[model samples]
Target: MSHQPDERQLSLNAFLHDTGHHEASWRHPESGAERIGDIAWFQDIARKVEAAKLDAVFLADGPAWWGTGHRPSNNFEPITLLTALATVTERIGLISTASTTFYEPFNLARLFASLDRISGGRAGWNIVTTFSEDAAYNFGLDGVPSHEERYARAQDFIDVVTKLWDSWEDDALVVDRESGDYVDTSKVHAIDHVGPYLKVRGPFSAPRTPQGRPVYVQAGSSNEGRAFAARNAEAIFTAHQTIEDARAFYDDIKSKARALGRNPDHVKVRPGISPFIADTTAEAEELSQYFNRLTVPAYGLTQLEKMAGTSLRHLELDERVPVEVFGGAGNVLDNNRSRRQVVANIVERDRPTLRELLHRLAGGRGHNVVAGTPVQVADTIQEWFEGGAADGFNVMPPLYPQLLDAFTGQVVPILQDRGLFRTEYAGTTLREHYGLPRPDSQYADEPALAVGT
Candidate 1:
């Protein structure tokens, strides 16, 4: 083990969407909606992030169609797209979302291992337990499983995947040509994992990857989600509309991680922030409103219905959203089931009109939305970064390429000037860049498990 003097650097990841996080961004003049199918455009965007020296670039994925007719919902499978991105960019870490509810542990392990090998160790997995009933139908299930059942399966899934990732020791591959022995067989071990939801027996075919395993990332913030992340996740992508809420969530995750006998610092909490940037705060607000105006009322209402888990068609779009309309998010103490709590908080705090609420959420889907100048945006980031509210941010630009460029070109320089973010790449692998130590294989000393004899 090695130690170094503490100097905290903010980690930023570019969350790529078709055009941007804004629901109507495709209608923006600066948007490259036509280039959504062009691989080179994505490659170019990835290059821009790499050049800015951000920590990583992330892609979100889902098996089911988004069921929305208004926005550009087309997407490439994150792994496939990121592989192409890996070829064009060198320093930026490539993270992809894959669901435990749908993927087998062994196959998922192999895919990410290959990605790690191909990218020279820059790979991260955003683990998700899919709860979409539409997604369940795709897999032949009548409906989504209970949350507890899905989480239990997720735990077993991660255990099997990690064991597979660790089955082959780092030094197992020894090319002794004269001896005609390509590997040291004694170093390889089988992980026989048996669980209520998953069972796997394996001496993984591939050798240990550069970082031991892809960085474990979790994306939910429900009570169960918090516990799972404490026990497993290295990084957490969360959603909170206020700094107070963000701080509360941050404290809870760290305390829980510490209580579980893990280093609190190891679990990085990053809330999503979608910024609308301009030369001045007023101009930035106008830009944000411009995107909001382009939104179709029908689409926003549909989205609201999904989040609230109830039909809101009876309400007028121009009127203030009733507090009681949020009947399905389980109230304030209902365990934070969905984005209902976020929406509830927004209504309770600001009393935004239905249209205004839609526009607010249209930017980042319960994530914080800020419209400001470069310095102001940088200030918000610095405030959260240093105020025990966040370790970093998931930079969700409302418009792709243009807004991303604005962030990288305008805000990033300010952050760098203030000594909050990196001005250059300091490491090659994602683990190194994120300040995490490379992990040793799980079979460093123990013999292979022999089971079901």
Candidate 2:
């Protein structure tokens, strides 16, 4: 399976998590949980991913610890860690998740801009309206804001941030030692934005980045999330249980972008995939089962309760999961839609017992999980890309170093050989890597007629 010179190439991002994505990943013998706090460990992962020619390295984060304390949760601040990783890696994009609900637009914009500058234009922001109630409590809120309210705030927040990013024009800097004119005042303007969710008066402190601005990425998958992503996102991260479902989501989001007069191709859809790979399918399955055996069922049940927004601890482990807990497929939630559907899909499709359901979702939470030989894993990735289910994927390894090495060493070569993925770095900046155009500053140029006439 090979394509001609001009065929579309896939985009891949290595999602960085301590140890790996499986809930029990830290328990695996090969996983180095002791090195979780070491920046060198993350840098090594970034370097390896860059060597594979993947598009980027994504770090997921939130304000509060999310797990049941049975495993290590997110510790590193994404932007800070990516900034350090940027120092070691050159070509790979650095994407950091920052919550719209938690950060002030100006502050968040500055951090992303700083990262973009530090990384030499290889920066991206994964916009998220945080869903964790624990996170809300950390902010001293009485309760989590309603989903509608959060999205509304997010819209205003992004508007302000984008304006701040565009506050300085490309030619604003004129570092002439002769006349000592450091900046051109005419090219810089204050946004003076006053919105429902944010108030900012600015010209950003930072200058324009090489890509003009950091690439805008989104990760929510609800109806409102789809609308937001369609209107503004350059790339999106999502989760799905099957190829058909992923295709449905991809088509729907692209259609939405088209209806909004946005370039559909500019909005790349990347679903997360957690692969447990080995030389043989049986060995891969065994490897996966080993991780499942290490899983703490009480922790999994607690997590399920949080996802479903209902209690399940009383249910017998051997009995099938309660479908009514999800409010059925049609009634699936809009706030945490992806996870809700994952729970519902498990109940309706497999009708698995509570214990079985936990095992199934142990790797990726809600994303597709495949345990197979390297070729089998590559086959699934290729099928998803060619079949319109994904532009690529947020590759989540089940265990760090081991699975990451297997994928980059084994699976990526197959993709490169098939002409589905790139063998060498095509571009340096994140925007170029994603095939997105660098946006002209919103402050650029006057009307053609006004200028000429």
Candidate 3:
């Protein structure tokens, strides 16, 4: 595929993890697990990401520890870590996953607002609802809320947070030192929001943030999640194994956005890509296998059990898992969109062995994992970008620093040469970098606005 003179270049974000996305990445010799807790290591990586001119850097977080100590479960909190990262990186966006279920609207709003200001309009929030029972227990809840109930809470949670973000008009902070009149009280508004789940009162302490509000990013593929994202999310992070599914998801989300009377193009759809790069295709394929060889089957099975919500003790590791085995998640898969459906799709299509399934997942969880030369990797990206399967790809490296180096130092140059990605940043803010407009405040400029409540 070739880009026309006026055609747009796709976006790319660095989906960085403590070691990497691979389950055994920490065990890899090239991984930076030795300094995973050091802030300087992340800072250095952020600098490299900026030098590559990426759209953003994202970190996935959970309220409670993830997994049962199979890997590096204790990770630095995304918002907190990105706040420190903000001090070092100048142009790239800082996106973090925050749970709407665990944090109050007021506190979450302030955290993002502060980050946006400190980063000079580079903050993006990946909104999520806490689903783990362990997370719920930490918050003193008896049990996790039902899927519908948590989503209901998430809807109100987002509404409340945005209301607070928009409580102050763009021109509310008028620091007229001579007149001793520092604030325009008339311009400020108190978003007296009373929703089914939350109640918040009065104007926010801070003024309107840079980029109006940090770009609303969400990651969910379930029906309720799609509806919520269609109305609110400016960017979506989704997962899929094939181009057909990716295209279908892209169309579904965009169509939903259009039906909501929002511009579909404004909502960029990016699917995850876990790439293993080498000079030659053969070498790259072997590189993936090398990492797969390092995987711990016990850990993978435990994770698989979590994903399928059923024990797989009866199945042999080396044997190919029957399609009926995933009928195991029959009811569970219907409700949960991400986990159970991924490998089931693989089984129906390629029928990989049970151990092979673990190996594949050990790469990027459920993301598309490819091992090839930089040119081939760029070709894969271009085909998807041009064929309407994606607006961009979330670059998730299996073995970080080493794999990240290969992607940026090797693959990114190829993408730049093909005119598939940008070589230099053209904007200062995350919204601008994403080709999204800085939104008007909830009650600014426009006199009659239907604020969500």
Candidate 4:
């Protein structure tokens, strides 16, 4: 048997949150959360990621506000924001999360395809079934849909959207000035899609995008979520606090994809990692502690309340959390179901006091949090890549330009020196960065079919 090629050429993406990855990043003096309403700030971040030869810059979004006024909220819409970023950046992939449960397939397809075209084929769509009741309310619904139902709808939604994207052939447009023919009508086919959640008729208004359909990404880690990723996602964003968990998830998703008759290498698994790098290990640890100290206890309690699906108002900050609050073994918490489970699992396994739990979650939920020197940080990334745990990582720097600068200036060079990452961009588009193929239109054979059949 032939030996498998090395998978050490890891792909890295910058997971851009409002201010930074640390929950208290906005409170830090160096962060730029004050410019939350400015598009230029986001564009600057995108340019930085591109300069570093990163595969993509991802924007996490929710349809409605889940956190109270105590924490930084998602202020800008992702599609529009990414579109603006695309105009300035030449190489970085721009990915934005949009909820299948709350959006029409036709509109989403149009928006993402437009971005891909504008960016010359560097757009990606992160598919999610919105989990918040607030999001449901905003969408004119009384409550959020059941988990199984949401996945079912998502499957259908993706089918319709992709079909629409493929409705027009690449050469559908024929600009013949003498003949006064702007487009070849015969080449354009109508996708009369009628599904359980959507009914869209005819060809897409926009032409085929640069990469055909934007790279499909998924971030859920549940059973249904894993199945969905195996079937559809080219890239996956996961949250795991430990190497053991990351490796398990990586193996499980790839194995599932293989069983489904897909090349497992086609699916890239990346876990969220927030690195707080400093000149020295002690300095990094101090910085981590500083952020931890700045965390608002009231906000943490409120977040826990949401995660636990039960109120923690009566409990003191120093009190030990009872497993019974998580509804014991038989209890089901469905508020933010996945997050609730993550927090519950941590509480049950570690049995930390309420204060300790808050500290652990201060750095953007359960994403791996590390504070160290540049070399140590690079070592962590290398170990994870070489050990079959991740493709690369979703870099979530704890602060703004400072943290981002440290990673790019300090850690990136180390990665390049080890022959793990590129010093300069290899291609012009996000597809080039990720080594993904540009998709062919399903309607490319219209004229041939019309004549033969």
Candidate 2 local lDDT, 136-182, one digit each (tens): 89999877788888999999999998987887788879998999999
Q: All models: lDDT? A: 0.88, 0.88, 0.86, 0.83
Instruction: Write down the worst ten-residue block by lDDT for model 3.
Output: 328-337
Error of 2 at 342 (Å): 2.4
Q: Report clashes for each candidate as comma-separated counts.
A: 0, 0, 0, 0
lDDT of 3 by residue, 296-317 (tens): 8999998887777678889898
The digit string of per-residue lDDT tens for model 4 on 143-238 reads: 988998999899999988988898878887789999999877787778777888778775788678878789999998877888999999999998
How high is each candidate's TM-score? 0.96, 0.96, 0.95, 0.92
What lDDT does candidate 3 reach at residue 13? 97
In angstroms, the error of model 2 at 336 is: 6.3
TM-score attained by model 4: 0.92
For model 1, the local distance difference test gives 0.88
Query: What is the lDDT for 304 in model 4?
Result: 75
lDDT of 2: 0.88
